[model samples]
Target: MIEEPKTGMNIIVKTVTRLTTGLILLFGIYIVFHGHILSEGGFAGGVVIALSFIHLMLAYGREIVLKKMSEKVSELLGNIGAVIFIIIAVLGLFTGGYLFFDFFGKGKPFNLFSAGLMPLYNIAISLIVGAGLFTVFVTLVFFRSEKK
Candidate 1:
């Protein structure tokens, strides 16, 4: 019987990535589940959720893979997600007629489904973050490595 070579990561890196990814997912679930109670806001919660996977990449990604992932799409998407958050904040100007208004607060703390367009931004952040991590990992694994 033939055995397959490891895809990329060493045993320790793979183990670390698995553990970190699991923990991050747990933390993200915690934040998303209770974001309203804490009043930390959904967008922030979404970012926290997204960052959890990023931690995995940083911990376990191969050197070449990490460099490539860090340099390109991951970085681009990270910045874009950041910009999206800013844009969401800027959108408040239109809704509140000023910056950082209640934005459908209606004088009461909103539930998970309560926040107006804030949820939309939250979803967007989640998309960017998840995609950023996925992109980095997929690219790194599939990318052809140049011989040193």
Candidate 2:
């Protein structure tokens, strides 16, 4: 027998998923881009993105493979992205006079993927943080055993 969805369920689920997804993506994009300006860019952004994904999962009941994939991809991108940022700083430290100093040797922020790899670092951290949250949520929410 097919269990018909309650009238309000669809509305509730759709509204929640759409809003969560949009907010996450928006904030994620904002953080990813702004890493150059602020200190914690990619990692923070990725975490925001992941939290948003979890909200979607809860609202939509896991019928969101595309959304899930997007979340996974975001995590990956964030990790690599943020790592590059740290690497850039380390490289600068080695070659340049000071730590995390890219202005002297590398091209300015205007150049291609410039900013001394700050953007990349933001992406990497964002992904890792987001993924970490996702993993925790899944373990607690899904794999968690309910006590009768």
Candidate 3:
């Protein structure tokens, strides 16, 4: 007997998405890490990460995706990202002797973890963007549900 239809797109679409979402997430991370060395930056990479989750939602529906990542978790993560960014700035003032100074050592050239505060900044920005966007999407999706 055929299985009942689930709460998402067609099987084919879901399969394709499953295959590609991982790659998309990987690419997003790469962009965030190599942003300084390459063209992309935190904002771009964060958007990509957010899009990967969004892609899953589009293919799998909010219930399934939300189960994996709850609204509170997303909001909390976004808040943590913001806090990290602020802490970095504040630390710079006290440790580096200037506002937004590079307190962390600048390691080898063209290497990961080489740019002192830059990588940290990128990570913080990525967290903020990715979680913030995903939270927005979840809120809007659920908002509509309550109305109905």
Candidate 4:
């Protein structure tokens, strides 16, 4: 008798991944949101976010992961993030007479809303980095060399 190949990891890894995936994702979001108030910033948060998705892909198969976030969607998100950043910059230029100028008033120090557009920038950066990294990962995973 011949044994069939498995598409994903064993049951234990799957169960563990299922339990931790959401937590990992949530942590990434937290980092993105609270970055200004803490040590970590958008880049760090974005990498964490991408890691969550990558974790899912590692535990499950590509098919399952792709269903959750298709290649098109990832590409679209990255574009949207870039557009948002550009819009923010343009708005700053028009309002403050400079690129990325902080027109909005900064709130109380040590507060969530204290960073006057920094948070928005962080969000955009996070989206870009997360989507870009995930797309790259997917591409690398799916890439295959043809042999004649």
Q: Tens digits of per-residue lDDT for model 1 on 13-61?
A: 7667766776777776666555545655545555665566556555554
lDDT of each: 0.60, 0.66, 0.89, 0.91
Q: How do the candidates rank by lDDT, highest first?
A: 4, 3, 2, 1
Q: What is the C-alpha RMSD, rounded to one decimal, of candidate 2?
A: 5.1
Residue 80, candidate 4: how far off, in angstroms?
A: 0.8
- What is the Å distance of residue 58 in model 3 from its true position? 0.9
Q: Lowest summed-lDDT stretch of 10 residues in model 4?
A: 139-148
- Cα displacement (Å) at residue 77, model 2: 6.8
* Pairs of colliding residues, candidate 4: none
Q: Which pairs of residues collide in model 3?
A: none
Candidate 4 lDDT over 56-148, as tens digits, reads 998888889899999889989999999999999999999999999999889898999887998999999999999999999888776443242
lDDT at position 89, candidate 2: 78
Off by over 4 Å in 2: 1-10, 38-40, 63-67, 70-106, 109-113, 146-148
User: Ranking under TM-score, best-scoring first?
Assistant: 3, 4, 2, 1
TM-score of each: 0.47, 0.62, 0.93, 0.92
Cα miss at 77, model 1 (Å)? Answer: 2.6
